[model samples]
Target: MKREDLLFLPISINVTNKKILLIGGGKVATHKGTIMARFVQNVTVVSPEFTDEIRKLPFTFIQKEYEKGDLEGYFLVYAVTGNHDLNAQIKADAEELGILTSVCDAPLLCDFVSPAIHKQEHVTISVGTNARDAYQAVAIRNQITNLFENGTLHI
Candidate 1:
């Protein structure tokens, strides 16, 4: 249940063609939603307002506030809202619905935490500190990137 537990964990789950629900429309939400679009079957974003970046993405957009009922039957949920109370509440609701939830910037309340990622040609590396020291994780990932690039570490 601690953030440190997520460190050095192996993650191979492919999210392609999964239903991902993103709750928020600001920069943070937009970033999360856009990333999910790479593989998720569909990304649904529910928020009152959106930035140009969010609007331009190829995903379902629902312009609305966070309602308790909105957290029903999604494969995954990301609560990135500016409203702390709503995020917490939605996280709880998602849990009750047996849906996996990740709360951006609030790892303690998340079932899954996003890790700092490093990408190379035909290679992707993810380093997570379980929400502990993200900066340190990123640094470690950079070193791994160097090794991988030089063929010292093979995926």
Candidate 2:
């Protein structure tokens, strides 16, 4: 499969007993980490440096450069490093270990892309543009969130 064949079917993944490894400590990682926290509790972040915002998250933070060994035992990986080369390496390492990886800003290297999501009680809604148009997906998600907030849309 190629990047052009990016047909990411929208589906829900059960992350129970999953250990998520996030390889970044900047703002992007913070955002991703915060989102993951909403759904799961076992997220570990490894980066040489971290943003103040990321440090506030309830996750295990390893203050060191990422290594291939980091992907071991991880169910899912997020290559959110600011360095493109590093993200690519993380993707490669994850693939070698048969772990699903999502590289920030590089959808082609991702096995899956995180979508703009909304959760209300027992209802959850996610919007995405096949990892090709994140801005549009976020816009649509915000609109849906507004509708739900004002009672214009119901589950």
Candidate 3:
């Protein structure tokens, strides 16, 4: 099915105590890791190599290649490895285990898409294009942030 054909439901999930797994150590993976760490207390990142940014994060890091059953105990998974084949395998494994998964740059393989988020105190705004147009989503998020900064939109 096409990405546009799917109807994505917008909802918030509480990952306070959930186990989150990130399979990658590159820039893309680091970005996802940083965002997930903000809400999830139990996050483990597995990768053979990592960028400097990810090394600074407080999450547990397993410096090794992802195995077949890496998604076994995680409630959610983010597959951001540069290798498309590995990412596909990760998605397939996560699905088999009924775990929610998001594969970076591949919306069709993702169970859910991550949105461009803007957070201020208790207010949080998210803009997404169903993984169809990331540029447009970021632009919209920036617009919303500007509105809030200019006091055009009150909290």
Clashes (backbone N, CA, C under 3 Å), per candidate, total 3, 0, 0
Residue-wise C-alpha lDDT for candidate 1, range 1-155, written one tens digit per residue: 66555543557566766678999999998878666655453888899998889888888899998887787657889999888888999998898899889887887888887777777656767887668887898899889888887999886
Q: How close is candidate 1 to the true structure, as a TM-score?
A: 0.81
Model 3 lDDT, full chain set: 0.88
For candidate 3, write residues 1-155 as lDDT tens digits.
98888666878988767888989999998888887666665889999999999988889999999997778879889999999999999999888899999988888888998998888888888998878898998899999999999999988
> Better model by TM-score, 1 or 3?
3
Each prediction's Cα lDDT score?
0.81, 0.91, 0.88
Which candidate should be chosen as best, given TM-score against the real structure?
2
lDDT of 2 at 123: 86
**33-55: candidate 2 lDDT, tens digit per residue:** 98988888799999999999888
Instruction: List where candidate 2 sits over 4 angstroms from the true fold.
Output: 1-4
Which wins on lDDT, candidate 2 or candidate 3? 2
TM-score of each: 0.81, 0.95, 0.94
